[model samples]
Target: MSVIQILIINAVLVSIAMVVLWLVSLRLKDASIVDIFWGLGFVLIAWMTMAVATQDLRSILLVAMTTIWGVRLAAYLAWRNHGKGEDSRYAAMRDHRGGSFWWVSLVTVFGLQGAVMWLISLPIQVGSCETVPMSLPNYAGLIVWAIGFLFESVGDFQLARFKSKAENNGKVMDRGLWRYTRHPNYFGNSLIWWGIFWVSASSSTLWLAISPILMTFLLLKVSGVALLEKSLANRSGEYRDYICRTSAFFPWPPARRHGSKLV
Candidate 1:
């Protein structure tokens, strides 16, 4: 199978999976499970791409890197989302749309997400399909992946800890990574894929063209930072104040708000 064919196959499979999940969600009355499936779906896509590609050093390296990323990410997201109810974003959509939610969600939510997933996976597909040897770019990709992984893991841990504490319950978390960026976890996630794309850019294919850009757009404009921050900004007063000081999607030194002292 050619690289393009492999990508199409991966996209179709994930789309079908999402459609099935959407149908099930309509019956089960929850959508958090979709989050778990989304993560796992990417792992499956990466592996499938590797399997389809002709055996070569590049293919092997791509598989190894992607598997490490996909597996860890899937596990973390699944563990975090376990037993949680529907994500607020979907729930809000359901509430607003009412009975029309079934169709709306199937096409707009599930289908759209499936397409984006495929777009974001383009770098992995391109990287894995081509033959290339170990090089500086590959090493750089690993370093970027490691840094992104740490940021994501640490950000998640800090937020989880804050939520678990009694006194901190329902409060905006402004310590640790959260103090620097409103969505450090998301920032890390975005960086990781860009790193993956950079590694893959060594490939003959130019498929990395869409991967990093799509991921960033999704993180900033679509579902990642925008949706979550919108909800937080509405619910938490401290969140608004934090936003005034902290960067939205990148970690940086907190800037002082008018009349507010920097900590």
Candidate 2:
């Protein structure tokens, strides 16, 4: 199948899935469920592309990497959000929209996310069509992907452990991977997409670079850092301190404060 055909099919499939999920959310009255499915949506597109496109080593590798990342992310979100009622973001929207939130959420939440998912998964779709032999960039991309996976997984584990402690309540997390960056998970996620794009890089596929760039833009400016920091900005002085010392999106050595040495 042609790349365009694969992308169209993936879009349709994702749209259908999102509509069904929206219906389920209406039944449960929880639009937050969309967050849990966000990762899995990419996995679905990866596998679907692999099934229809060329089944070479590169395609298989893309599918594997996507599956590992997507499944882990979905599982993590499911666990973290378990028993937590609708996320505050969605709850506020629901309250503001009042009785019309059911239909409004279908367009704003599910449709928007589904569209983004399809766009971000462009590399996987296009790369799966590549039957050419893997080159240097492909191997390098794998290494980058491994590093990102480590950061994302370890950072999440550390944060989860910290949050699980009762004494840590209202405390800013400035240790572990969080010490280097205010948002290790978001940084890692951006790297993961960039790695995917690198693996798929080719003269013909160069235009698809937008896939990774969009992901990075979303992480740094849109939903990830910007939105989260806005909420954290008013939380505590410690968070403000953490922000001052730590990099916002990239991993870097923390800046030292008066009377405190960098750890």
Clash number by candidate, in order? 0, 0
| Residue 112 displacement in candidate 2 (angstroms) | 0.7
Model 1 TM-score, all chains together: 0.88
lDDT of each: 0.78, 0.91
TM-score for predicted model 2 compared with the true structure: 0.97
- Report the C-alpha lDDT of model 2 over 27-142, residue by residue, as the tens digit: 99999989999989999999999989999888888999999999999999999999989999999999999999999999999999999999989899998898678899888999
The regions of model 1 sitting more than 4 angstroms off are 203-207, 256-263
- Model 2, position 136: C-alpha lDDT score: 95
Task: Tell me each candidate's TM-score.
Answer: 0.88, 0.97
Candidate 2, residue 155: Cα displacement in angstroms equals 0.5
